[model samples]
Target chain A: GESVGLHLPTLSVQEGDNSIINCAYSNSASDYFIWYKQESGKGPQFIIDIRSNMDKRQGQRVTVLLNKTVKHLSLQIAATQPGDSAVYFCAEVISGSARQLTFGSGTQLTVLP
Target chain B: SQTIHQWPATLVQPVGSPLSLECTVEGTSNPNLYWYRQAAGRGLQLLFYSVGIGQISSEVPQNLSASRPQDRQFILSSKKLLLSDSGFYLCAWWSDEVYTFGSGTRLTVV
Candidate 1:
């Protein structure tokens, strides 16, 4: 099954610095994309989402960029805080349905002070 | 003010035992409900989804089944437990262009 995957399994960044997590999906039919943050012992929390029609969308201190040309997605967190350290996932859904979401393996972000 | 509620924070069941996990959504109606399972350090795996009462869609074939008797209620059940079934279970609801997830249920089949 073609699914979503992260380029890096783990990432380390200094506090206050920007962090970028990358994802590559193989499903061209995927038109809706979302970013989720999951802390240990908790369910996933939605951060931001972008539709295929748009290339970029920004929310709060987070930004999601989608590139349909390469089937790529990225999440950027500005001024990363200590609490920002967690596993980030990129999920995609095919057209006409937000019911079924395919999630990536996820990237673990570690913020260092 | 939509919220999702899942019962029994944790459970330990022996093999061959029956299992049932329930989830309910408040402050919403006719919402899309989904069931997901996550293993240690793994991504969310979609198990089942329901668009309305008595309408259940299975994503992956396993030892589990889902049912929705009402608009805001979803349930996961299994007749026999498999050790491989031990994992974290989460219920989610999509409504008003927003997605909300319950705290989650930790199941251990020993």
Candidate 2:
């Protein structure tokens, strides 16, 4: 049962606006892709990766968009602050499996003020 | 500068008791170790993984168990402690470009 899901459990931006978090994957040989940033208690911070041959990848202000036809994966946060809120994860790696990482179903970004 | 450490950040075992969770990695060396679990809000749940020292790979088979003697060390065991084993416990390492997590261990199986 290969699964990695997230269609937005929660997300709200305002600070500087511009934010988008959405992920949907079921593993189609998943070729490495990651985006993580979890604050609340820390642990899980590495915010940009894409390697299904590469579709898009940018860091600093964050940006990762990979749509292997439709597996879909996106995370873009340009200005939104408030420490950028919290929880945001999307991971998938199964191209010979370097160490296995299949995460998703997490999106709770609340930045407003 | 690489670092990853997981310990008793919080734990309160009970229900049959018996469990150990510890992961260590510093500056990397033969790196590639992971153990993740998260419940409260869901996501991140890839049980065990190791690439050296004794070698282990179990993506969830229940009861839980994992160990990687040394070489950055990694261990997660359980002989009992059910109650769904509470939640939150992460330890990761794998850097070609990313993945470095620790500072998480909050079990509570009362």
Candidate 3:
């Protein structure tokens, strides 16, 4: 079975620095991508999403870049704050199906002061 | 605004005990419902999905089963839970745009 994976299990960053988390998805058929942030003991909150037709999309202090050629997706956060410390996950959806989503292993982002 | 609700934030069940987790969505109708399980420090795994009432699709064959009795209610159940069933169970709803996940339920089987 194909799966999505994170390049690193954990990422540490200093406050005020930019943070980037990477993901690789095995399903080439995936046409839609989304980034989610989950704080401890909470449900995942949608951060941003990008469709296959576009290469990049930006939201408040966050940007999502998708390189379909390499089946890679990355989330970039600016001015990392201690409050930004959480687990980030990327999910993929195929073209024909919007009912199911494939999720990547999460990366724990820890911000250091 | 749509919202998802999952009950029993945490549960400790003895092995072989029956299991039931309920999920409901509000402010949305005819939306697709899904159940996913995440093991400790692992990615989310799709377990089941429902497009409509009485229609259930099992993604990965296992001891788990799902049912949709109403338009916005989905249930995951097992006749006898296995020790391996211990994990975090998440309920999600999908609209035309994106999916919304519920506060997951953590189940610990002894």
Q: Quote the positional error of residue A65 for candidate 1 in Å.
A: 0.8
State the lDDT of candidate 1 residue by residue for A1-113, as single tens digits. 88999999999999999999999999988878999999998999989999889999999999999999999999999999999999999998766554578899899999999
Interface RMSD of 2: 8.1
Best-fitting candidate, scored by lDDT? 1
The DockQ of predicted model 2 stands at: 0.33
Off by over 4 Å in 2: A1-16, A19-30, A34-51, A57-74, A78-85, A97-99, A102-110, B1-14, B17-36, B39-45, B48-79, B82-84, B88-107
Off by over 4 Å in 1: none
Which whole-number lDDT from 0 to 100 does residue A99 have in model 2? 53
Off by over 4 Å in 3: none
**What TM-score does each of the candidates earn?**
0.96, 0.34, 0.96
Give lDDT tens digits, candidate 2, residues B1-110. 88887898899989888999998988868888989889888777888898788889898789989999998989999989899989889999886656788889989999
RMSD (Å) per prediction:
1.2, 14.2, 1.1
lDDT of 2 by residue, A19-113 (tens): 99989898899888888888876678887888898888888888898988998989999988899899998989877645588888789999989
Error of 3 at A12 (Å): 0.5
Candidate 3 RMSD computed on C-alpha atoms after optimal superposition onto the true structure: 1.1
